[model samples]
Target: MNISLKFKQVLNASLLKPLLASFFKPYCLLCVAYEGGELGLCKACLSDLPWHSAPQCPQCGLLSNGLICGSCLNLPPHFDATYSLFSYDFPLDSLMQHYKYRNMLPLASAFASLFHSYKLNGHAGIANIDLIIPMPMHRDRLKVRGFNQALELARLISKSTNINLDYSTCQRVKFTPPQASLPLKERIKNIRGAFSCQQNLHGKNIAIIDDVMTSGASLNELAKTLKEAGAAHVECWVIARTLAKSNY
Candidate 1:
């Protein structure tokens, strides 16, 4: 690239960016009400969010648990705790689908804002996070998706909380099928041995960040892997949690 072209690129980003953003109004992805700011949910929608701020059980965010879902009770997840901002449903699910599959990168900022609020409200087990780890995307999957949605959200959360993020320390070694597409029984097998965490996390509190939690097979596997690597505790912080077996 020519020096002049580089200069023009910088100039456009610095000057034209604000001008362009100002030209268009922001609106909620749900109601299309003008208020989402850089994110996609207006104030009304924001307040009305099915806030799953903290789960009674530090394990699964699934509602069937009714204070500590049966899954967690019967077979506790390796992760010590889990928390989410909203229950996965309607417009939120659609918005997340679009954000994840349809390449809506800007929506990450809105999701990150909710995580910031979670911290402010003092969600359980998030008290002292030694490290922030976004659920990793396999290298092949990364090329197809263009970016890791979890990592994008985690980047902002890491910035807000000033916690260290170690994406390189953990990796998705296998390109497993999407858990949502698989039967509940197959979900665990799909991701087994799929992650490799390089660091020795003994006594470290690791927050596994992700866009949503459905069956939680992925987070569970990640937590199990982290445990193998000596992580003292692994907690998951997700944008939404699916209550039903069906992908909401």
Candidate 2:
């Protein structure tokens, strides 16, 4: 099946499955209100969450009023573009914390559904995407965390988009400390040479899905590795983008 047709099927399924599930189990994740339609949030709560609608740089996802930000112009990232669904803020941050640290696994479905909805609205070059890759976690971190949140998300997204998902070709070789815990200035250095791609990806347009993008150091390094392995273009498809300048 083609990308467009697969997207339509996923869209239809996303809409219908949520409505049906809501009827059977109705409680919002945020307010405990009845009939939490999608993502387990009532319509009111969902609307109030910080959705990323503002204009931003296509490369790094930082605010730039819809144009390529000067940051990207000055120091271009390895990734060609970024498509983020939410601003990392307030309850959204709390939600991500719960999902990542507290093991709220069901939120993966919520996140993937939101991502699907965003893609359905249309992107100029999405159809050209040749593969989906969830950011890799080193074996040590995987043993500690018990799961790679990025992989959980990519699994659902790949199923919906019919895009080839490649999880094994790339591996995180360095077991560096979490980027979020490090100082911004040190993050890039800490993540450098952390990724290794075993397979050649010549001329492929690849998308990397992650739960959040803070300094983007990890993504940048991963993109660099992919480019070295001959990927033609790399796109970061993150669920949330930290809007704070400090995070960048």
Candidate 3:
């Protein structure tokens, strides 16, 4: 064997194989240990996750079984309806953080599976969607992250649903600060006019896919933009939703 090829084989046996083996083994992200699946979360951790299965607002996807949550009923959101796979809490929140800020791409597939498992119930199926638009990230943020987590999730969803993915249709017009750092009121202002539909969406039932929904401000703003651009309906599909804080 050539010297270079022999050295390459040695490196793979001594370093690469062991490293990859450790990586593939299911180690829980919350608590370090073998989980059982590629999710890196054990069955117990998965079961303990705060899944949102309660009654939800038909419009904004808030957890209220009635026709709408108080916030949505009084002042309707721009999006016609919203749905999420899980609550933004506990281990799931941690998982999202890793995926978004930490650039953990593998976790995106796990999240997609959760979204797929969500019972549509009376909700519209992917067949009803004319286009799947992922919430866009500013150029600066996109450059730094290399990839948008929402887009990653959307790709997986499209593969499963066979819906048309339209990444270039909706574009981010401005670079804004992270929404989590801003106050609730500021979030709306920050994202206003931030997104614009580049392609005609007339009579199209669009579905906006996002990784998280905190105050629903960003989604509302994007939906409003699509509506003005001639979209017939705008629905939201998110991976998680931050629970509302109780008033004292």
Candidate 4:
């Protein structure tokens, strides 16, 4: 086997072994308090989490109870639908920053569990998805980070839902300015035409996975690219949504 495949096999074996997990419990990256349980965070932290309970815009995934948020209703996104697990605030935002920027990879799995635990109620229509595609990073950024947070979350999600995870099906051709550093309009411009599909996605229903959604520009661009590549439908699955300033 190739070196990369061998490493992946070792990592998978380590992740699957309960005894190995126990031995590394105290050092677990996501475990706020390793009390010998499998859950990374203590029950208290889990219970007090600021989960996304408000209804959201069916298009952009912004928190809203109405048919759609004003922003989305006025201007629809390329993606057909969006869903998120938590609101981007306080402890959740802090945790996400750590996971995304600080290389706390274990937190991805914890966030995935949060996404898996969410019940769609009667919205089963939105939950039945075919494939999970994480937003791809430019080659340069991927080299620096060693892993994509979105891909890590997607892996956990795939394990939970038994869904297909296609990491290399989409490629990011541009190494544009970081979306967080740019204005909303600039962010959209930066990501436009940045993504392309390498494999056939014709007639496939794809769910774009991401660590968080701020302006929704990246997801919109990706969805548009997928649609152009003959994807029948595109949905977004995100870990957190940045609430509007008025709601805060």
Best candidate according to TM-score: 2
Q: Could you tell me the TM-score of candidate 4?
A: 0.82
- TM-score comparison, 1 vs 4, better candidate: 1
Kindly indicate the candidate among 2 and 4 with the higher TM-score: 2
Model 1 — TM-score against the truth? 0.83
Query: What is the C-alpha lDDT profile of model 1 across 1-248, one tens digit per residue?
Result: 99999978886896687556545866566774656555567778877777775434556766543476666767788888777788888768888999999988878987898778764367644567899999999999899989999999999999988889889999999988888899877988888999998878898999999999998889999999999999898888899888764221
Residue 87 lDDT (model 3): 82
Model 2 agreement with the true structure over 145-243: per-residue lDDT tens digits: 899999999999999988999999999998898898889879988998999999989999999999999989899999999999999999999999998
Pairs of residues clashing in candidate 4: none
Error of 4 at 107 (Å): 1.1
Regions of candidate 1 where Cα sits further than 4 Å from its true position: 1-22, 38-40, 53-56, 64-66, 245-248
Model 3: pairs clashing at backbone N, Cα or C within 3 Å: 55-64
Of candidates 3 and 2, the better by TM-score: 2
Q: How accurate is candidate 1 locally (lDDT)?
A: 0.81
Q: Candidate 3 on 48-154: residue-level lDDT in tens?
A: 88887787776776767657777776687778888887889877888788889888887888778767866443355657888888998888999998999999999
lDDT score at residue 130, model 1, on the 0-100 scale = 92
- Model 4, backbone clash pairs (residues 3+ apart or across chains), number: 0
Model number with the top lDDT: 2
**Candidate 4 C-alpha lDDT tens digits along 134-207:** 99989999899888999998888888878799988899998998888987768877887999888777898888
Q: List where candidate 3 sits over 4 angstroms from the true fold.
A: 1-20, 28-30, 38-40, 119-124, 245-248
